[model samples]
Target: MQQNLDYQHLKAQIKNWALEIGFQQAGISDVNLNEAGKHLNNWLQKQYHGDMEYMARHGEKRYIPKQLIPDTLSIISVRLDYMPAHLTPYESLTIQSNKAAISRYALGRDYHKVIRSKLKKLAQKITEEIGDFGHRVFTDSAPVMEKAIAEKAGLGWIGKHSNLLNSKAGSYFFLGEIYTDLPLEPDQKQGFHCGSCTQCIQDCPTDAIVAPFQVDARRCISYLTIENKGPIPVEFRQAIGNRIYGCDDCQVVCPWNKFTHTTHELDFQPRNDLDDIQLLELFNWTENEFLNKTQGSPIRRIGYEAWQRNLAVGIGNIKTNEKTKQKIIATLKAKLDESSDLVKEHINWALNQFQ
Candidate 1:
């Protein structure tokens, strides 16, 4: 009974320590996700995950926390806002056909590394207090139902766009989790407050949000530009506009994002002017230049081939005069003999857009 009391006290301390460690908020939740499991199975059955096979690979292990880490009793979920201060607005970048609209999240360093390191520190702090405890930390790196877990932890309710929405903090934040054996008191789940708003669904460039809470990944520009390795689908190419990296139209249009706070972490600040670079300039990057520029950025994972492929799509969507179009055509023609067949195909498609 004394041990139980100590754990209850420890839970309160964990939340305080989390805030001290730079997390915006933290909450605890018990390890039961039966309803989330059912929803996962249904989404997988509908093939909404697109080519991300890993989402299906975890089976029931994802929802059953004990299966992933035996003897786990609760989870501590933390939120960190990642929106950078003093950057080009998302709407302005989208309208500039020549400018590359990289997602706000990727404009800075890779979040997987940043969030994972912070979660590790939080775990170590817990160890310092309790002697030792079984815990596994995750950012977006694992097969974790992060949003579902975070929502259950009372960080926020899942908004209509499917991102976690805190009434006070908004949706422009990152989530990390610490799965542990501690029997912490679970937080009360926050009620949904989306009301009748449909801004996110209406503003999606590709109409990826097929329903109020359903997003089809195949139609999502973020998935197409980032996760997909093949050529961007011809059908969606025109709709993609100049978004060379991930898309943020849904979040940008979310009314709640008006209350979003700028991140104090310097690590999330934009690198290499990614927040406002032109498509032609990014397209002009040689393979070596691509590697060097994206070294620590999440954009590096897409590789040089996909980088050029996405740029080709972005450039093709550019609205320019015949003289400038000719200049663009000349630049693309120079890479014809050197580009890989897949990239060449996209380039060829891009060249056709001029005609």
Candidate 2:
């Protein structure tokens, strides 16, 4: 009876069930990722990954899906749109130096939880249909090459910025995977649609995109603020501007994002008025307050020190009235004695901006 089961029909059903379980799109692909592995190896060899040592840690398992999860014949890739509708324009926030400019993706609930829960549900639905098939769900939680797998699965193509792009959905989404032993029919891979548009590369505040499809994480604002635990590089501080958490300059300037869809997922919506808060307001948050406000949110992972360190840089970059400048200086000075060395270093640099 099991041998006679129709895997192709089951694949179609899995796509439908994924949408019903809150994923925007689902596609299947075989476990082959030789090309992606090569690209990854080249990127790692060039040391473009910065302090993200984990990107080079897993040997071949990071690209070879079956090696990571044995017997994984096929990979089911899914994307969920996370851009909230009617939010403050990212451009406006960048110019309003007094205001905090956070990456839109981190404005709401932690996506790791949201996408992981949805992936588990989709897997459970498949289990009910297939009777306990071997599968494991992942949402940015493993050494999975999610973007590469998604591209091969026909969900999208890897854009010049190294992010997956879809003509219909742009790049405002999160990716998840289901590694299963089911021999499902793989979908056709999507063609590269970026054309001659170099907006993402040209508009990167830190020039992180060194060339077409190549991003040096060491110079990337997102990496500096979020991934780099110590003080941000002095050269990039002014370029960092008011982006307190993560930078969206590349995505904001992408031509494809004109077709970006607003997510309907409530979990992706902004919480704690983060969408339009001031830099000073966030800078004033006590450690307990920061933890309380960011509970279950992605920003919590950065912890208070890095959070304050980023905000101090943002506050220092403010182009404001003399009165406002004095207030900012006072606020920055007040924290120096109490701050950790990391935060103290940033605060002092921010103060130097005034001199």
Candidate 3:
């Protein structure tokens, strides 16, 4: 029997186990994310997260895993690739400039479910080896500074785009965490390699990046489309370009993406040809079609009315042409007959684009 528990040795074994369990990388870190806590506090004070009031409610518990989970000695951070291949995210966004550009991450099955399932399996494996440990698995659950913990665990430094960047894997991965009492040796923190690049700041179509490392979620297309429940204000709608659900402009222009590898995870691939689907075609999806097509996908969470509203904005943004203009008007009129008042308002606004 192994007499001394080699924390370092256990860490290495866990890393190997995580890789075998579909994680791109695994890292261990002691429970401290104070720097990120300050950032979160400052961001909350400035209301940068918009209507996400939960960001402010957790206080220090959000950063201190031990405070939330007693005796949390270590955090196990894991990354999984999510960029699906052969979908051509940039080309579709550029060519069909009026089409809705859902963030590449949400094109597939709900990542929360996928990552949670993997994390559950990882936790079970640890229980098998170490015999019933104090642990909680998290994939974007409340009060967890996942990115901060991951960065501290040496997964990658936070990029200017405010996403984790792996030197070998790029920034196109989802992060999940396991909080455990196991005293695994910490990994050396990854140093920031961003240098002097500001491409992500410059490439933001809606100018959401107000400063270096500061994102105003209010102006962010992703937040406006997915989180805020109301008419998208006129001021930023034109700047929103073709993006509907979430904007990937920052990531698209990042130099690091050149080294990006395609994900083999089938759940991440575009479903129902979401890749190149036209704005008019998507706008024409019946409520039933919308429900069925987006079932089990992240887009389903936005529901039908918001889906149509986003599509209406996309339709309005399209280049004015005879057939395209006619189609937009025709779609708007169809909605008028059966749409709820909120959807009708968006439909009328889109119809006005052709006039």
Worst 10 residues of 2 by lDDT: 1-10
RMSD for all candidates, in order, please.
1.4, 0.9, 1.7
Window of ten residues with lowest summed lDDT in model 3: 1-10
lDDT of 1 by residue, 69-98 (tens): 998899999999999999999899999999
Please report the TM-score between candidate 3 and the true structure: 0.96
Predictions in order: lDDT:
0.91, 0.93, 0.85
Prediction 1 global C-alpha lDDT: 0.91
Q: Which portions of model 1 show Cα errors greater than 4 Å?
A: 1-5
TM-score of each: 0.98, 0.99, 0.96
Ranking by lDDT: 2, 1, 3
What tens digits encode model 3's per-residue C-alpha lDDT throughout 44-84? 88899998877888888998887899889999999999999
> Where does the lowest 10-residue lDDT sum fall in candidate 1?
1-10
| Superposed model 3: Cα runs more than 4 Å off | 1-4
